[model samples]
Target: MVFRVDMITLMFGLKRYHHLLILLGFIIATVMATEAMIIAAFPGIEEEFGVSSVIIAWILPAVMLVGAVLLLAIGSLGDILGKRRIVLACLIVYGAGVALAGYAPDMPTLLISRTLQGLGLAIAPLAYALVAEETPVEWVATSIGVLAATYGAGSFIGIMSGAFIIEQIGWRACFLVMVPVVLLLIVFAWHIIPDHGIRKKGKIDLIGMMLFAISILSGMIAITWIGLAGISDPLVWICIGVSICSLFLFLRHENQTEDPLLDLGMIHEAPFPEITINAFLVVFSFFILLQVMPYLIASPAGLALSVIYVGILLMPGSLTDMISGPLAGFMVSRKGVVIPFILGALFLLFGCGIYFLFPMTPVLVVCIWMIFSAGMSILLTIDNMIVVASAPPGSTATASAFLHTIQSIGGALGPIVAGAALTLYAPEEAFTVIFLVVLGVSAIILFQSAGIRRHLP
Candidate 1:
């Protein structure tokens, strides 16, 4: 009875906050869903284009890398140009990119279209900032959690439906179908989101932007190339050296710049570093599972599952995340962020540990994946909450952008790392090794979670 009253009070306390959260959630979900949609369509694309697996692999990473490099710059632009304007422009670009990708006549054309679509990746961080700015303090975490849940839900729908759509109407049509939905979202967002809110006064750090872009592009290319080609390749080493030096220079430049792209001082603060590092690690682990699972299930040496079956196997994880996301928000609202954060880490630890010990089988893989996804849902929600809450006032968008840039880098690395593992070892052994490494990383994340408790609200 008391709980119900509190819930009612909470619901009524915020004036139309739910509508804003839902709209922002839908926008973030649409962008994220496009990512999964492409992943689901990869096999079909490979078959149609007659491309080698290595070349097909570049499609997703190309998008992720482009988006990763541009995210911080776009976030800063949002601060300067207005979040609503930037987001609306991104949607237009994204929709056009998708449409072009749907009609792409060659692999290069499709790759270019995918990279263009990535321009909208800025929407996620910008939306997070808007939510943080608009929502009351008490409701902030819950709002973010719901947004995360919707993102999971969107991914689920995209992956599951994408496979079926490809089976029926071809993979190109999959991109085409989303065009109208994105258009509707553009219209909806225009009305719901406030046009004028916060604006920072300063020119964009163009030098910092260029440095960061080169650093990220070089680093991601090096990582991706290392997976595709062996470490012995001279180009890989050159890229690695270039990436390292560029990053060092970028960091120095950021430290010295007045209006830096990343705001180095905020990144140096407590919880921010921990939060960002863990974001990278967790996404790194999750992407390994994501990229590898389809191959694992479909490979003849493994289960030899169909594309539809592969999608089915992965569906539960998204569904579990969809359910767990809101629950994680409630837990954060009631019990603080630490409990959910710790539980999330522990869940990932157990999930990876299970796969390490067990033999690879379709059923066992799906079951353990569910466990992993549940943990991931909690972590995604809490991580966003912590990042948004811990960010210095007026810098929420930049902080969220910085965190996502790290995550995008991790995402870009995941398939490459997993691909390299498969190339280096037999399928069975490679999966086992991957899980073992992920298990170790999850443990490290668990330990890191303990340090953030003191920093949480």
Candidate 2:
């Protein structure tokens, strides 16, 4: 009887939960590809639509606005609703959005379709939460690492494949490519992603969702308009003011509510706050590099390579991400988290230093960037692990969403700050500013490395 029960448990657990990593990988890769392809195809899209660069930029801004506002709300809903149901719904919505985007006849239609895509994109964090709950403790880091690397993988694929498709077919073909990919991935996800047996049954906090969404919407729109349009615009100023006021109210609402969307107390954990701050600054600093290398490679300042060759340079950074993510996970699982976190920060600092000192040498720069990218990947991969581990049971999704939402905000701000630096100084000088900030943040992390290790699993 004992042997039979053990066998039954093995069969059910193995069949149900073993491939959580793989499913999350597929989700991350698909979502990243979707976002990256849209960004890569922007030039072609602008030309096709007969719009200015600024107008084309609005496409992504619109998508991001929706995502920034709604991700936490959607994630909380995932807790109330079944995560699998939300994942399925999001996949269908994403696929339909891709199809609509592919056939968009004008800018308005494209904007609408992209907004739909953003709503779907908000599900990415929910997927992360699902993986956190379902994956075994032994391999959680590796699992999250793969999910982290998927974004880099997607960016690499999008930059390379989107350019090829635009060259061979047209910009519209890029959107069409995702439709099939989404449909296929969704089918696999439905098959493999096991249902976590615990379910929360309750009414979602509608008031919290509305206030949070409004706050995020106003903030994101203000930021977007300031970055792409002029900050002096009356609309931008109004949005900024409204965002501030709304966010204050939103926080107050969440704080007073019996069941908050995000319980504010979780962030008070030692590692959680430190890691969150580190992730924000590191992402903010490195994301500038995303544009920097591409700009240098495209412009006269650097190699002036074709989009194809530039894509190759991006590969090292992404390939490093692919390797570092899993390896960081393993390190955290075995050696503990602090060493990897410190090392990741050091690599980012090194990358910035190299870029500042050797701005003219493309090959050297790429090599330095690989170091930075690998380190950044490690930090990100481990940070997720840290966040999940730090949180109390069942708050994994909310914690993950909170961290990622901040990282997204950092990513949004990075280019704007870097772009401004570039306008004022040489590329090297701008990189100096970026890297100094990164190094300063890393130093802070290093100082508290011992404290962080104390808190980790």
Candidate 3:
């Protein structure tokens, strides 16, 4: 009788906070879906706007760059101000961006809308921070895993549905569909999430913010320009020089600042640097596959799959991620992060290897992609947990943002690097180069995993 009673109480206890998980999942899904849905439709947008391939390539990276540059600053703001307040503001901007994107009359207008939507990138870290703070320690990893799974699910929806919708009603309608979804999320977030939570007492670091943004922006732009116009281009070299100077200035400012946007002290802590570096490498590896695979599929030399068919082929990977995400969380809860991290690294290496060895057929490619996606799904979940765990109490959002900044840098660079390879080399050679690079990175990740394991408590 007592055992039954205890079980019932535990069940109800878990259920009591289920709404928060749902809200976080919804937000995560929305953000991921919004970002990914446009990827399959890139060719469509390029055709409609009559833009150059380089310009078309810039679209997704532009959004990622804006988000990457602003994430740390916004995260610091959430730490100083309230997270909920930041969430509400970002949602408003996101909705407006979606609306504008749907109605965008030209390439410039679409780019502007994407930049606006980038502001919402802060929501993921903030949402994770909120959940981390509120959830019991025992449930933290699982909760985060659930959100990670939801992220994969969102990607699946975005890619699968976005392709279908773009095919059926045109790409503009795809953006329009998200506007209402964002609005609904805003309403739910406002009502469900607590208005007030933890807030750090500090003034904003204006100099640090500016320098950091300039540094990241310049560096990313320089890379893109190199890819587009070659390293011999004067503009490319100029941007590179600017990036180096800005980065130096940002580092100096952060080291000296009284209230740094990203605290140097915290970042220096054990496992933080390792985890952050790991995140950068992981995203860099995963995105090479994500961005390059589409080109390979659609290229005449390859399978030459249509946009919708390409989406269908890639769907399994996202679905695998959706399934593995929560499983990663469960593993973290029981065995700690080291095991999951090691397993994820192995999976990533295997996934990359599969592509290297296999013949490029639709069925074989789909199977390999599913394996790769599963690896990424696990890594993504475990990495988030590691970041959250490494953070100082109440600074979860800031730590997450810092980690994401590195990851976003990887995300922004992946497509550019792949695009550059494709532009410079034959399709087969370019793909081989990409896979070899990713494989090398995966090996580095595996090495790092060992180091992490030795340090694990």
Candidate 3 on 384-456: residue-level lDDT in tens?
8888887887788898888888888787777767767776678788889989998899899989987786553
TM, every model: 0.92, 0.84, 0.93
For residue 190, give model 2's deviation from the true position in Å: 2.2
Could you tell me which residue pairs clash in candidate 1?
A: none
- Supply candidate 3's per-residue lDDT for 226: 74
- Number of backbone-clashing residue pairs for each candidate, in the order shown: 0, 0, 0
The lDDT-based order of candidates, best leading, equals: 3, 1, 2
Best candidate per TM-score, number? Answer: 3
> Cα lDDT for residue 206, model 1?
81
Ranking by TM-score: 3, 1, 2
lDDT of each candidate versus the true structure: 0.79, 0.69, 0.81
Q: What would the per-residue lDDT of candidate 1 be over residues 1-457, giving only the tens digit for each residue?
A: 0111235446678455566787788877787777777666666676788875556666777777777888888888888888878888889998999899899988999989988888767688998898898788877777787888886788788888877777677778878988998999889777667766667876688887787777777766676666667778888889888888888888998888888888888888877887888889888888877777767777776788777776688788888888888899899889988888899999899988887577778778788888899998898778887888787766778888888888888877776677667766787788778788788889998998877777554
Clashes of 2: 0
Q: What lDDT tens digits, residue by residue, belong to model 2 across residues 1-457?
A: 0111235447666534445566667777777666655544544565678874345545655565566566676666677766777788778887888899889999999989887887666776776787777767666677787788877787668767766676678777888988888988788767666555345555556787787777766765665566456678898889878878888887888788887776777787677777887777767666656645555665544566655555666667767877888888788778877788778877876766665565466587568768988878888888787787776666666777777766766665565554545544565565566566656655665565546666654
TM-score of candidate 3 to 2 decimals: 0.93
Error (Å) of candidate 2 at residue 413 is 3.0
What is candidate 2's CA lDDT for residue 81? 67
